[model samples]
Target: MKNIWKILMTITVVAGAALILSTAAFAASDSKTLTINATISARAELVLAPTTINFADNSPTTVSSVSADNPVAVTARVRTGKATAATLTVASANDLTSGSDTIPISAVSWTASGAPFIAGTLNKASAQSGATFGNGSGTYNGTYSFFLANNWTYNTGSYSATVTYTLTAP
Candidate 1:
């Protein structure tokens, strides 16, 4: 009888504790999330070293401009993304020809040395008194700008001078 009473008391206490806990309510909440992504791009442009140039006395005048040889303006430019240095060279190609009424080319010669007169000193850009360009990539890829000597000997006809350029990588 004593043991039966103790078991009954324990069961009654546990039931009372469970009933009190169930009576108490808990708060409820909800949440949401949002996400986004990004994109990007880089770019560059060609940089002309000698953007523009002018020859001191390139205009060919029969009598007045004879004494002095016409100076050629060389334009060197490049496009780059990284730091670099490059060199460009100009050489003359002897493809000179004359019209039917052609005067022998041997008789006439330009004051400037066999093409690529290179002004006073050549084979060096350090002597460039004119505009010089570099993109840091050390590579120059673009059209070369220069003035042809105005002094010429002919019977009145169109003439041409061929020039070749070699670009070097840094």
Candidate 2:
């Protein structure tokens, strides 16, 4: 009877220890979700019309007035992103030269229209210059007219000069 009671007490103590140890260990769980984002930007593009300008019916005769026979028209097409204004600049390759004599670019007068160049008045420049041709810019088009004066004294032999137009956005 004594042995049985001792063994029974041992088994009950072991079972109680196992129950305590099982309660000591625990399980926990949590869950969450994640999201990601990205973006792309738009690019600006500028295009010009009539890549070349040609003047015709130039007079070589002696004259006292600026003959306006040859007038060439130019236009621009632009596309911009989040820009409010743009500029167009005109440049001459070099002065019209013959031997040692030179004719400055001032001889060519320019006129602009569509909010900057005024519709009817003409603008003249002595060298390379720029003007605002667009406003509130998304995509816009503008026009310009150029005329070469016919009154200048020089040795004549097919005088020529190159002109360039550039556009900028900001």
The candidate maximizing lDDT is 2
Error of 1 at 17 (Å): 31
Per-residue C-alpha lDDT of model 1 across residues 6-86, encoded as one tens digit per residue: 999999999999887876644365578888876532223334444333324333564422221233333334434455544
Q: RMSD of candidate 2 to the true fold? A: 9.4
The lDDT of model 2 is 0.56
What range of 10 consecutive residues in model 1 has the weakest lDDT sum? 121-130
For model 1, state the Cα shift of residue 91 in Å: 2.1
Residue 123 of model 1 has an lDDT of 20
TM-score of 2: 0.52
lDDT of each prediction vs. the true structure? 0.40, 0.56
Of the candidates shown, which would achieve the greatest TM-score relative to the real structure? Answer: 2
Please identify model 2 stretches exceeding 4 Å from their true place: 1-44, 56-84, 98-101, 116-130, 133-135
TM-score, per-candidate, Cα-based: 0.30, 0.52
Candidate 2 clashing pairs?
Answer: none
